[model samples]
Target chain A: MKFDAQWIAFITILRKEVRRFTRIWVQTLLPPAITMALYFVIFGTLIGSRIGTMGGFSYMEFVVPGLIMMSVLTNSYSNVVSSFYGAKFQGSVDEVLVSPTPNYIILLGYVLGGVTRGLIVGTIVTLLSLFFTDLQVHNVAITVAIVVLTAMVFALAGFINAVYANSFDDISIVPTFILTPLTYLGGVFYSISLLPEFWQGVSQLNPVLYMVNVFRYGMLGVSDVDVGFAFAGVIVCIVALFSYSLYLLESGKRLRN
Target chain B: MAHALLINNLHKVYGNGFEALKGISLQVEAGDFFALLGPNGAGKSTAIGVICSLVKKTSGQVKIFGIDIDKDFSAAKCELGIVPQEFNFNQFEKVRDILLVQAGYYGLPRSLAEERADKYLKQLGLWDKRDTPARMLSGGMKRRLMIARALVHEPRLLILDEPTAGVDIELRRSMWSFLRDINAAGTTIILTTHYLEEAESLCRNIAIIDSGKIVKNTSVDSLLKTLNLETFVLDLREPLEVSPTIENFSLRLIDSQHLEVDVTKGQLLSDVFSRLLQEGVEVLSMRNKTNRLEELFVSLTGSGAGENDEI
Candidate 1:
């Protein structure tokens, strides 16, 4: 297909993916915002009042960036996993599969769709945080770049999960067993500096820890991990995940016969 | 004239070691309406899947409009459209959006996509249901929606797997007319149908497949001409005590009121009527036991048409 046509095909898939989640805003958009708002109330205000500042900032302020990143990560991952798995389940993905659309274009379209939802939900949670705490961004470029990059990484991961998923239960297994635990343990509510030296070393091995730290550094100008290394690590994850997802699509794994 | 679709030595084997297609080769000429008749598990759907890229071929060559699929499938697929047996569209999407989205996948501009969507929706009689979600449509309407969606891309070749399965006779006839119009206008169509009568009526050329191979491939008229014997069931006006003794014809009394008679080539129907009349038997009505192509299909496939025949 010509480049122009491929672009149209990409846009079409993206449009369909966007409309899918938007059509069910109550399920896709609302729950995350509500969940994040409750976290701010229960964890930041109610619990943080007893604990002093960590990482050179108040508990509420320090936790805001982590909460936002958490929403972005989960929403991005869930959006692609659910949307792509739904397409596979309904066999609607055959629409693009039988078309002349390139594999890369299809992957990009879905990845961007996850990114869009992730950013939208992330912004919603960020705004919701303002009601509980005054949020500040130390570096706008680092903040925007890391968030977008992090969303892309998780979106790619979700795409891979959806590709290998055979049933509705399969799509949920990763998020529930893997993603949720990683977010909680990834230092979302507290900095890893407070952990014992051995546990801090173990936490460094968790990829989500790097993402949350980079995002926290962006928002509060403080991070336990090196920001440069964290950015490079997220980029590496994106490249690896994107390549694998593209290979799955090109090979027609699970999507085709 | 160029061939619209060509498969040379095509083969497909499933992961479970079931060889669905065993080197089946066929050609469909441009502008012809073709029927691929087969029994269940005869590999008709698998072949179509390979051509549409829904199924991977173990070994073979498939080309659409002279473009080789393996070499450049994207280019080959651009000229092809398929309506699978199952309803595969998003059920929650409005009818019009489905068509428009399909058009966009083929790189149709918004104006052109809308125009084509409008044209096909109106043509398929789904214009009024444009805003309604696909799940709300009846079985026949959903089939029409799929056909419209396939045509929105204006593909040169269209493959429909049992396009009229489960459709009412009245609606089936209308769909046949619509398909005839499109084939006349130069879209090559390959249809698989359980209704042999549908194939006999709409398709000019046909291939009957059995056990993953093309048992017979010829024009519809030629295949029908090869059926030298046809059975007719006669409803008698009164109950008969025994079968009538007709010379050079086989007759069996299905019950007492109905008799099945086989008439071979060069046999006169008038002779049967005369013989029955001479035997003091009155016939109320007479109809063929099965359509011409159906009889030949059973004879070739060696499988009773009972389980496979939906018509």
Candidate 2:
């Protein structure tokens, strides 16, 4: 491959994807901000005041990292799924496929587009969290790393979902049946330690639990799961999902022919 | 240096056991205006799909300018452009944005892309619609937009599949002039059209495919030469109460002031005029009853062009 052409193609797709979502900012960017605000108002402010504290931090502050992670996760996943599926549905994907853009560049460009939305929403949700409670970053590196990795993993997951989806309904099924349930049980509103021993083990089986805890640990210096194990798990999942996504792209699964 | 396009033994079988193309090999020399015509389901689109990498070939070698598609696809693809029969652009995107994004796909810088976008849009009479959303454009303008988008990279070879399928005649004529200018400026063009007249008027060489095979491949003049008989429609100076008869001539009275006649090989059209004049029917104007190539295409493909065939 000519490296310059590859980079150019990647940037082109990335920029186009960004322009698409940004152009419809009302549809793409606003809803999440409103939803996150409602979550902060309802769960963190009203319910949190009565609960008082958990995990050695104020209840509002305790839920802040997870909420931010939730925004990042969902936004990352939805952005790629909708955008990619739209491309396929409208046959606009043919534009890139018939061009000199390499498959990997196409993949990276879309993934980065998802990542961009994820981080933007994450930042907005984080800023919203500040209004409800004073927050501190116990570890900046872990905070950035875990959030980035989690966004990437879900973005890859969304890419795979879009590839396999034959209809618009197929794209939303996984998020509805799997992602929502996993995130809610992943300790966003409460620590898994509050659950019974068996259910806590069950909660640990959820991948989102690992991400939310890692993010929480980065913010509050407190976690129910081992920080080292969470780091390892997130890295492994990222590597595995990234490899699989690349494989699907290289094989042109659901993309070509 | 090699031919502008070379496909050797290309084959494609759909998942449902229908073979769309079967071991078709063809070449278009550099700077040639070539036409690929076929009835519906005759494998023209399939062959194009294989070359554009939109469809996976079961087996074949495809080279663009001597660069094998498999070995150097980016380089090969960068050297070509495709205007598909369908509109495949992002509907929500502005027309100029569509062209710019297509340019970016080919690694052209923004400044050059904008320059080319303006140039092609102006040439195609689409500069005024640059800011409008694509879906708002008329069907003819949308086709023009696809052409502008394809040419942003300044590709050496351009392939058009039924480019004027739904375009109005006035727009089609202007588009033909635009295409002629580009072809004259040295961009090799490969066209597939249902309009046999379009092919007959523009293409230098032609290939007709049927049932996944190339039925005829030759120069346009040579292909037309195979046409042994051509029918002509004549407008008369006087109204005829009845159809006229000329020796060894197949003539029919279309109306009071019109007549249709067949002129076979080795027969002079002047003789038909003289014979008609002797019959007291003065000829005002004469024209082919139908496109000459359309007739030949129907003969070769075993089916008519621009009809109900949907392969």
Candidate 3:
């Protein structure tokens, strides 16, 4: 496709993907906001007050960043998997396959849709966090950068999951058995520094741990892991997953034939 | 270069190691109505799949409007539109949205997309259902929706894989005229159908494939010319208690009021009338036992030409 056509094509798919999730606002947009609000009441107000302060901040302030990050990660991953797989199951993917649209545009369009949803839900959860405690942006540049980067990383992962998924069940398997556990153990509720030395070493290997801490460092100005390492690790993951997703689109494994 | 579509030595082998198409080649002239006829598993859809880029080709070259798919697939694809055998659109989308969204895929701006979407929807007689969800459409309407979607881009080449399957007679004829008008206006069309009568009445040129091979490829007239015999059902003027034996013509008494007559090619119908008059059996009216093209298809595809083939 020509440059202009490619841009239009990307925008079309991106708009369609956004419309799909937005149209189902009750299921897509509202659920995360409501769930996170509940977390603030239960975990932040009730239990957090009893736990007192941690990491030089009130417990409510500390867990707020982690809850926002968790919302971003889960929403980003779920958006792409469900939307892309819905397209595949209905064979509507062939609509784009037969068009002049290039492979990368298709990948980017879906990824951006995922990222948009992630960020929207993340922002909602963050606003809900404010009602629980007074929160401040420790670093404006780092906050925006980490939030966008975190959304992109998980959105790419969702794209890969959708590509390999042969069934609706396949799309959910990773989130149910793997992603949920990673987010919980990724220092979302507590800093890895609070763990034993052996488990902290193990937590270093969990990719989600880096994302949560980096985002926490952006919001709280303190991180259990090195700041540079967190950013570098997530960047490498985004690049690697994006490349693999592009390869799958070009290969057309379960898509074309 | 004069052809709208050209396939040279095309082949396809599924991952299961089953070869669906074996070195088949074809050329469809611009503004011509062509038919790719085959029985179940004859690879007609596979061939269309390869052309539309839905199914990856194992090996060969395909060009649309002289642009080779491999070298300039974007240009080639822009010139092409395909409606597959099955309904593949989003069932939840409004009918109008389906067509409008399809126009966007080809880079049409919102204004032009709405214009083309309105044009095709009205043409396909789906205007009343424009706001209706696609899932609410009947089977025939869904089929028409696919056709409308394909034409929204105004592709130079249009491929319909059984576009009229299961449509009622009225809607089917309307679709036929719609296709004819577009073809007359210079859009090249390639159709695949189980209904031989549809192909015989609509297509100008034809190709018959079976078992991963092209059995015949020629003009429709030329293919019909190969028929050695034709069976006609004659409505008798009067009932007969005893069937009369006729010389030099194969005859069977279907009932007292009907007779099945098989006439060899190059034989005139007047001869049969003349003989029937001499036998004191006045002729009323007659029609071919089956469509002429159907006879040829059955003869070419062997026992695989299932009269009710869903494919």
Candidate 4:
């Protein structure tokens, strides 16, 4: 329909989403920040001191980008999956389904909300990390671009998860089983170079590893994986997830009926 | 009158192979307050769901204001508003904001949506709670808020599914008056309620759907005329034994002091009165049980009529 009208709907849904998380800041925003702080304390301070260098940079500096990306990924994915699923469970989603707003606009509005939360949490964790270690960015543009792209990719994944989720348990299943394993093996604490060549090749297949290393490269100018390959991986994931999410919305597969 | 809604042989079967609707068809005229009456599991909601595209229809077609919902859903939905049976608004949002967001979904400009939101909220007695979150409002207020949200875009046809389900008597009356006022202003209202009296009072044309089939569809006046039985309740001043004069009329003694009788259209009431006098039975007061429409609804739908069974 009209541009202004679609913009209004976008802003309304975004505002509602932002308010929902902020209203329960303890659960939505604070826990992730605190969890990241614990990782910095336990992993960076306690463990990193025992094992000094990780891929040429100091242990604290090497893990900062990975930890920040980790927070961004988890928060963005959880924000959208939980919010959209909650709307579905409460039947409030019918408000959008019955309206004249285009399906793509609805999907984008929710994806943006998720991305916003991810960026917000990522910023907070980055600031928290600064207190423990002196932070420096070799390329601010690449760092910003990689973090935003990573958030977008994960947000789209969350929307797909929400669409397929029939119960609250369904929402948590992926985060615990799939996401946790991927992030753990994504070189958050150690470089993939330390593993054997075969394991390194296997780790190359983990998408989160590419994200973490690329973000590390942006901050430290060093990565266990090629920066170009990392950026390419992020772009491919974004395109694929974006197209798939759009297709799901257009088909009205599980969301509509 | 132009038809506002036309359904032709709509069908719906669930993925599990359970059929909810079976070839249902009906037409609602422009500006006509049409009531679809049926029991639970009778597919009234399923029919609404299919027309709104919230549920997949197995076959048939639905046209809203001459636009096919299947081919031109956006255009069709733009002209229709549905107030669902459940409270589906965001409870975290303010009453006014809920309506504004719904209007935005319909692609209405901010200024226009806000103005319409204010108008409807005030008319529905929800303006005082405009800034309150929907969770804070009572059930009746929330229901009214939904009505306000549905009317924000000012569609040509409005479908209300049991809008007064759990509301009190006073609120129900006020809601009915508000709906009637809106209908008078040219909005076609399609209501589905278990309360048959509400339908009988508000709708001129009615459709009785039973077991997912249209059992009766006709003007209210015509349906009432078909019921030839008129019930008369007489209060007797003195208790009287059985008399042969009373045998001429079909009568049942409800109690020692009250007698109920059914009088056909061709029978004269004066004859009953004269016969009662001849039998030495004093008649204190007499009144018709109710309007003929009540009897017609009971007989046609086969729902027994009792004073407490108004719904």
Candidate 5:
């Protein structure tokens, strides 16, 4: 009920979450950084050299924003899904649930934790990419806005996943079966314009494609997808996921019982 | 005094049509140490769940401190604190942190939360482990930490679900004393424990639930009086086989040299001694089994002995 007190709960959960991942930084923070570096090396360097250009920009430059977005999305989603599910699995979520904290406060506390991890991993990957190719941001506002919004959207998605997950494997199933496939097909390395007209239209439906193109537009001032549509798509996903996650918490589906 | 917790016609039927609670109703008075005793699968946990809003009730209403849980859940919950049976604190956090965070959840400022955290952690004898991660503490310590966390908000009613289960005798005794102190200070305590002796010692009012219904609900003294079963044990100086005529004493062999029997209040012990002597069974020393609550619990639940008596 008190704003100051609710903020304290939010900060407490956020601190615990940050400490949880940082305590095992080798597992939580380092893996994504290493994976992103590998992507920059293998796809950005080796493949980009052979492919020439994408959307009027050098392939390496074009892929930089997409790869960063990929890291943000995966790290943000996994940070919340794994942490929240781990709490449930360990039977520690009862500590939070039994407390007087409102459902929305708990939801935001976890979302912020996810966003923090996303931003940290994104920063690390950005610095890693600099070792291979110089990058520039055409619009700093759009760049920061897209990264934060994408992280927020995915973090909410992860919260929903944690709500329904009965086991640890359930948390990873979405990433393996759905997330990986969508990311690989979401224009991380090549422009959607290169695909056939039918495929181009089909790719528009993949939410990750919209995110990747939006980030690309921010960094290189070029995108195969319409920039205005990309921004609208990200905003809509954020609002939708946020409302759905809050509804799930309020209903206590798979959570209270 | 107003009731601290009131449940009216509560029902919970699982998805498979297994009714855990069947229109059960009960009231716990303010400042009363009420014990809810039942066998496993008898809906003890389900009742607690419904009261805490963790499990949905198929029908009925729950009021805490005169506030309807359905219409004013936050206000109702503000008056209650639940110490679950499971150790459910964030194990990665320190003992002090867990308590402080719990206080914050109740809308307490940081300074007030810290003060209450320190107060409870010290009172629960967890001050020394304040900096230790919860996961690293012993089971007893963890259980105490949960109690501390629950009490941080100073709710009017506290619900403890098996608070002493799996704890050592020393810790359990200390916990009982702590609870007694809290109850004396006017916090209504509702406890569910497998230990009948705990209820006998701490609770004045008791409810015996079986198959989701209140089979027996009465004052502890009245319940014990209704049983009228007194246990007497005689230790014999010499081992002897009792004569068949000694059956008049209604004795059973507790061991080769010992005889045990349950006698009503008006029954005479002298008659039993004379009958045993007539049968050539030597009696050296006699004593009464003082754990009357255990005996009553066994009788009411229709369970033969103490082995499976834990609820």
Candidate 6:
């Protein structure tokens, strides 16, 4: 395909994905917003009141950035996993498979669609957080870069998950058994400094810790890990995930007979 | 004239150690209406799957409009359109959106995509249901929507796998007319249908594949000519207690008023009628016991061309 045509095809797939989620807002968009609202009400407002301070800020203030990062990563991941898996289950992915659209265009389109949803939901959670606590931006550049990069990383991971998924249950296994546990344990609720030295070292092994801390650094000027290391680690994750997703598409693994 | 599709030594061995297409080779000239007939598990769908890149080929070469598939698959894909045997569109999408999105996948701009979507949707009698979600449409309507979606890109070659399967007769005839119109407008068509009469009525060339091989590849008229034996069922005006004796004709009494007669080469229907009349039997009406192409298909494949061929 020519460059111009490839661009059009990319846009087409992206639009189809965006429409797929937006058309079912109650299922895709509303649930995350409502769930985040509950978290803020119960965890940040109710529980954080007893906690004096965290990382030199009010407990609610410290937790807001972590919550927003959590939403971004999870929404980005789930959007691609469910949308692509649904397309596969319905055999609707054949529409693109039979077309002249290149595999890279297909990959880029779905990843961007995931990123779009993730950012939109992240913004919604951020706006919701403002009602409970004041959110002061420590660094605008770092804040934008980390969230976008984090969403892209998770979206790519979701794309790979969708490719290997053969059934509806397969799509949910990663999020339930893996993603949920990682997000909760990845410094979303507390600073690693509170942990014993050995546990703090173990927390460093969790990728989500770097993401959450870097995003917290961007938002609150405080982080449990080095900001530079987090940025480098997230970039490496993006490259590795993106390459693997592209490789899967090129190989037609599980997508073609 | 250039061939619209060319397959040479194409082979496909599925993951389960089953060979679907065993080095089969065929060609369809541009603008010709072609029929690909096969029995259950006869590798017709597998061949189409390989051509459309849905199933990987174990070996061989395929070209669409003279563009080699292996050399430039995307370019070759641009020259072809496929309406698969199943309904593969998104059920929740509106009729028009499906067409528009398909057009876009071929790299058409939004304006052109919309124009073609409108054109094909209106042409296929789907304009009224353009805003309706696909799942709400009837079976026939959904089939028409798939045809519209395939044509939205205006491909030079169109391959339809059982386009009218399970469709009502009225709807089937309409789809045949539409397919004929597109072929008339210079689009090469390759169709597969369980309805033998459908192939006889629409296709100029016919191919019968069985057991992963092409048993017969010839023009429809030529294949029909090879059918030396023809059976006709006759309805008699009066009940007959005994079968009629006719030389050079095999006759059996299906019932008191119905007779099954087999006429071979050099036998005439007029002669049968005259001999039966002399025997004091008056025929009310008569029809062929089975389609001529169907008989030939049965003879070639050693299987009845009946319904429920999943492969």
Interface DockQ of each model? 0.84, 0.79, 0.78, 0.63, 0.53, 0.89
Model 5 misplaced stretches (Cα beyond 4 Å): B236-249, B252-256, B268-290, B303-311
Q: Native-vs-model 3 lDDT?
A: 0.89
In model 3, which regions exceed 4 Å deviation?
B303-311
- Of 3 and 4, the candidate ranking higher by DockQ: 3
Residue-wise C-alpha lDDT for candidate 5, range A1-257, written one tens digit per residue:
56776787788788877888888899988998888888888888888899897788788898889899999999899999999998888777876776667888899999999999999999999999999889999999989998999999889999999999999899999999999889989999788878999999999889999888888888998877787888888888888888999898887888776
Model 4 TM-score is 0.93
Which of the predicted structures, 1 or 3, would earn the higher TM-score when compared with the native?
A: 3
Chain B TM-score of every predicted model: 0.92, 0.94, 0.95, 0.89, 0.88, 0.95
Which is better, 3 or 4, measured by TM-score? 3
lDDT tens string, model 2, B94-145? 9999999999888887888899999999988899999999999999999999
Chain A: TM-score in each model: 0.99, 0.97, 0.98, 0.98, 0.97, 0.98
Better of 3 and 5 by DockQ: 3
Interface RMSD of each: 0.8, 1.2, 1.0, 1.7, 1.8, 0.6
B138 Cα displacement, candidate 5 (Å): 2.3
Worst 10 residues of 3 chain B by lDDT: B302-311
Could you give candidate 1's fraction of true interface contacts?
Answer: 0.85
Tens-digit lDDT track of model 3 for B218-240: 99998888889889999999998
Candidate 6 C-alpha lDDT tens digits along A1-257: 99999999999999998998899989888998999999999889898888879888888998899999999999999999998988898888999999999998999999999999999999999999989988899999999999999999999999999999988899899999999988998999999999999999999999999999999999989999999999999999999998999888877789888
Model 1: per-residue lDDT, tens digit, A15-61?
Answer: 98899899999999999999999999988999987888888889999
The regions of model 6 sitting more than 4 angstroms off are B303-311
TM-scores, in order shown?
0.96, 0.97, 0.97, 0.93, 0.92, 0.97
Per-model C-alpha lDDT, please? 0.92, 0.90, 0.89, 0.87, 0.86, 0.92
- Which consecutive 10 residues in model 4 chain B have the weakest lDDT in total? B302-311
